[model samples]
Target: MDKKAAKILMSTFWGGGGWKSVSTPFSGEDFEYAKSQGVMFDPLTITHDEIVQRLHEIHQDDTLQERVVTAFLHSLSTKKVHLRSALSSWALTSQLPLHTYLERRAVHANTSACGDCNFLRLQSDQEYVDADLNVLNFERIKWGGVRHGWLLYCLMDLELLYKDTDAISEVTPEDQAILVSLLEAAQTGDPKDSARSLEKRWKGLFPSSKQERDALLEIWAAAGLLVPTDKPRRGKGGSGDFIFVATWQGDDGYNTDAALRYFAPYLPEIL
Candidate 1:
C-alpha cells in the first residue's frame, strides 16, 4: 500500500493521535519490534516517506505484516478515544454517555464530500445528518440489527425532538403551552379524549376550530418535534383509538447541533 493508505490505516489501529509511549502490556514488545523495523512507535514523529518505507518492509515479510496488523487491531480494540475533545454549548444538552460510547465504538465518516463546492450546502448538511445516522445504525448493528434494539439504546437517543432554534422562536409562548399540554395528554391519557380536550383548550388560546387546532398540532409534528401513533386500534364497537407520544422525553432530541458537535471527534479526518 502507499504511504497515505498506510498512514490512514495506522491511525485507525493506533488511534488518530498515534501510538504513545505509555507503558502497557502490548506496548513493550510491539514498540521494540516496530522500532527495529524502522517504524516509529509514535506515528506523529514519523514522516510520510518513513511510513511508506515501513509499509514496504512489512509487505516483503508476510509474518511481520500479519503480526503488526494483528497487534494494531488488538490495541485499537482496547484503547480509548473521544467522540468530542472539545465541548460546545450545544453539546451540553446531549443525554448520551458519549465518552463511554466512543471507547467501545469505531466511528467513521464519509469524507468524499468534504471539500465539494458545487452543491456544498445541501451535500454537507446531508453528509452530517447521514454521519449521525450511521452512528445510530452502527450501535443497532452491533446489538443485533433490530430497530431501536441496541441494548445501550440511550447512546443513540439524542435529545433533539424540538431543538430546532427556528421552530422554538416561531412557536409563541401560548402555542408552546398548548403543545406541552398536548404532549402530556397524549402520553398519559386516551388519545381520542385528549384530542377533544385539546380542541376545547384551543378555544381561548386562539379563536380556532377543532380542525384548526389539529392542524396546528400537525405543524409541530411535521417539524419533527412530535410523533403520533400510525396504527389506529378499534375500540368498543367501532371507535378508532389513536395515541400521541412526544418524540422526545422532555427537551431531548431537540438539538441536532449538539448531537453533531459531540460526535465530531469520532469522525474521519480529511487530509
Candidate 2:
C-alpha cells in the first residue's frame, strides 16, 4: 500500500479516535490480526454504502467477490469472509441497526428527489417513532467498524441537539410543556422536583386507563430532566412536598434560540 493508504488503514483499525474496538466478543482478534497484516481501507473518501454499490456493479463477474475481498483484506484484514458475504448481508437485510442504517443510507438528498428520503422531515412509524436519541451504548465499545466517521457525524448532531440550537424544534404539546419547565429549573441550577410530580403533570395526557404514568416518567427522567435531586423536605404548614417547577419556551429565563436554529432548516420556506 502507498503512504496515504497505510496511514488511513492504521487510523481505521483504532476507530479514528484511536484504539482497537470490537463491537461483539466474536469480532475480537481476527480484525486485529488483519490490521497487523496490513489490511485497511479508507472509509472516509469512500463509504460503506459505496462499497455495497460497487459489489452490485461487479457481482455478475464470477470472480468479483474474491477479487474485492482480496483488495479489502490487503487494505484491512478480511478475516475469512469474502466481499460477497458482506455485500449479500446488505442486499438481504431489510434494515440494519440505527447506526448502520443511517451511515449506509442509499442516497443523499432532501425528500423531493429521492423516494427513500422519507423527506427526513422526521416522522414516526406505527408503534415506533424515529426519535434520534444519544448513543446509549457508546462507552461499551469505542467504535464498531471502519464506518466510524459516520458515527462521528451522529455524535456531532447530538451535541448540536443538546446545544438546543436546531431549527426544527418540534416537541409534542406535553413534552413542550415539560421541556419548558425543566429548562427553567436548569437555569436556576435547582434540579429537584416533587416525587411523582411528573405523574401529576402528565395525568390528563391519557384520558382513558393509563397503565402507569410513573413508569413512563421514569424513562424520561432517566434520559435527563424531570429528575429528582433530593428527598422532599417537610415545610412550615406541616409536611408539603418540595417541588421544582418547570419553565416553558416562552417563559422567563429559558433559551429557545437553539430550538429555533434546529427547526429552521426543516421549515418549508428555508428548506
Candidate 3:
C-alpha cells in the first residue's frame, strides 16, 4: 500500500489542494478534517505547474489508475479527505499505488481515470460515460485543488437504481429539492435562526441574505461536500479548533459514514 506514500499523497491531495471538510473532527478540533497520508501543503500556493509535475510522476505507470481512482473515490464517498483540485498532490507521495492505478487504467481509454477527467468516476461498475456537464466545465470542474465530492453521493444514490456513472451527475431537481429540504431541516436544528446564523457564521460565502446563506449551506450539506481541514485560521482562545464555514449545505448521514470508513477503513474492515 506504500502506507507512507499514501499518507503523503493524502495530505498533499487535500491540504496542498484547497479542499477540506466542513464538519469539525471533534467539538474542539478546530480543523474539519486531517490527512491520513500526511502530505503537508498549503492550498494557496498550489498551481498548474506543481500539478503538471505531480501528474508526470503519476502517469509513469498507468496500470494502477483505477486503484488510485478507487482509493480517491472511496475517500470522497466516505469523506476521509477531499481534494482541492484534480492535479493530485497526493500522487507526489503515493508513488507505487498511484502509478499502479494509472498504469492499469492508462490503456483503458474508454474510461481512463488517468485521462481527461471531466467528471469523477466513483463506481464499482467500470462503465464510464462522459456526457453532459451541468454545473461546471471539465477544466473548471476543479480549482485550488478542490470541489464538492458530489459525484460520490450521486453514484451511491443512483446505484440504488443501477444507473451508470455517466449520468450520475444529472441528479434531478426533485432529488436536489428533497436534499435541500433535508438541509433546511438540519439547519433548523441549531438554536440560532437563519438570520443570526448567517451573520455570525457564514458571512464570507453568503453575506448577503438569509436566503442566500440557507441556499449555500443547503447545497453543501445536501450534496455532501467536503470542507477544508488544514485551514490556517484561528478561533476562540487563539487556537485552531474552530472551523469557520462560509456556508454548509448538509452532510447526509450516509456520506458521513462513508467518509469515516474511507479514511479509517480499519474500523469497518476490522469490525
Candidate 4:
C-alpha cells in the first residue's frame, strides 16, 4: 500500500476538518482545501488497478462498514428499502435495543476504548435512534456504525469517479437525478452558480423541509459532487471554513451565494 496515497484518500473520503478517531494518520483538515474542489486522491505513483485492489483488500473483511455498504447497495438495487429503514432493520436484527447496541459500540469518554461499560449512555432505544439520525444528517459517523450508510455513499462516489471497473453496480436514482438536474442547471447560463440558487432550482426534487434540502446540498458539496467556485471562505464569526459546512448557520454561510458549480468530472460515465 502506498501509505501516503492511502492517507490522502482516507482524508478526502472522510469529509470535514480536524481530527477524527476513524480518519487517523491524517488530520481531517489535511485535505480540506483540496477536498472542497472535488479533488480526489490520485497519486502519480499508483495505478488505478492498484488503487482499486487496495480498496478491495481494505474492505474484504466482513466489518460493519462493509455490511453497511452491502445494505446500501441492496437498497439502491431494489428501490424498495429506504436507507433509514435498512438501518432500522439492522438494529432490529441485533436483538438488542438500539440504544444498548449503539452504546456498546460507543467509545468511552476520556479514553480511546470502545464498548466500555462506564461510557455515558442514552436512556432508551428511541433516544439512540433519534441521536444517530441527527448526526447522520450531517453525513458524519461516530461510534463506527452510526452513520455508515452515508460513509458508504461517499465511498461509492469516490470509486466511481476514479476506478474503471463496474464494481459498484448500484447507483441511487434519486442521487443521479439530482446530479443530472444540477448539471443541466449549471449549463443553462451562469456556470458558477451559488448553492442557494441551485437549491431553489432543485427544490421540487427535495419534497421535504428546507432544512433537508439544504443538508442534501451540503452533503453533495462535501462529497465533491458540487465544486465551489473559490476556496472556502473563512466564517465572519470565527466559525471555521464555509465550504464543507460543519454547522447549521442558516443561509449566511455556505448557502448565501451561487458559489458552487457542477463538478463535471464527478459525473459518472454510467450516466
Best by the lDDT measure: 4
Superposed by TM-score, candidate 2 places the C-alpha of residue 225 at a distance from the truth, in angstroms, of: 1.6
**Model 1: per-residue Cα lDDT over 104-167, one tens digit each:** 2222323213222111110111111112232332221122112221111222221111121211
The TM-score values for the models, in the order shown, are 0.21, 0.20, 0.21, 0.30
Candidate 3's residue-wise lDDT over 1-271, tens digit each?
A: 2245334334432465455443221222211222221221112233222333444554564543333334333332222222212213222222323222333444344323443221222221222233222112111212211222223223212221122122222223343333333323444333223322433454432113343333333323322332323333222222121112332222211234423423332223322
Best by TM-score: 4
What local lDDT score does residue 249 receive in model 1, on the 0 to 100 scale?
25
Model 2 over residues 92-144: C-alpha lDDT tens digits? 22122222225433354432122222232111121212221222112111211
Better model by lDDT: candidate 1 vs candidate 3: 3
- RMSD, candidate 2, Å: 21.3
Write down the lDDT that model 4 would get: 0.34
Q: Ten consecutive residues with minimal summed lDDT in candidate 1?
A: 80-89
Q: What is the lDDT of residue 4 in candidate 4?
A: 49
Off by over 4 Å in 2: 1-193, 205-212, 230-271
Q: All candidates' lDDT scores?
A: 0.27, 0.28, 0.29, 0.34
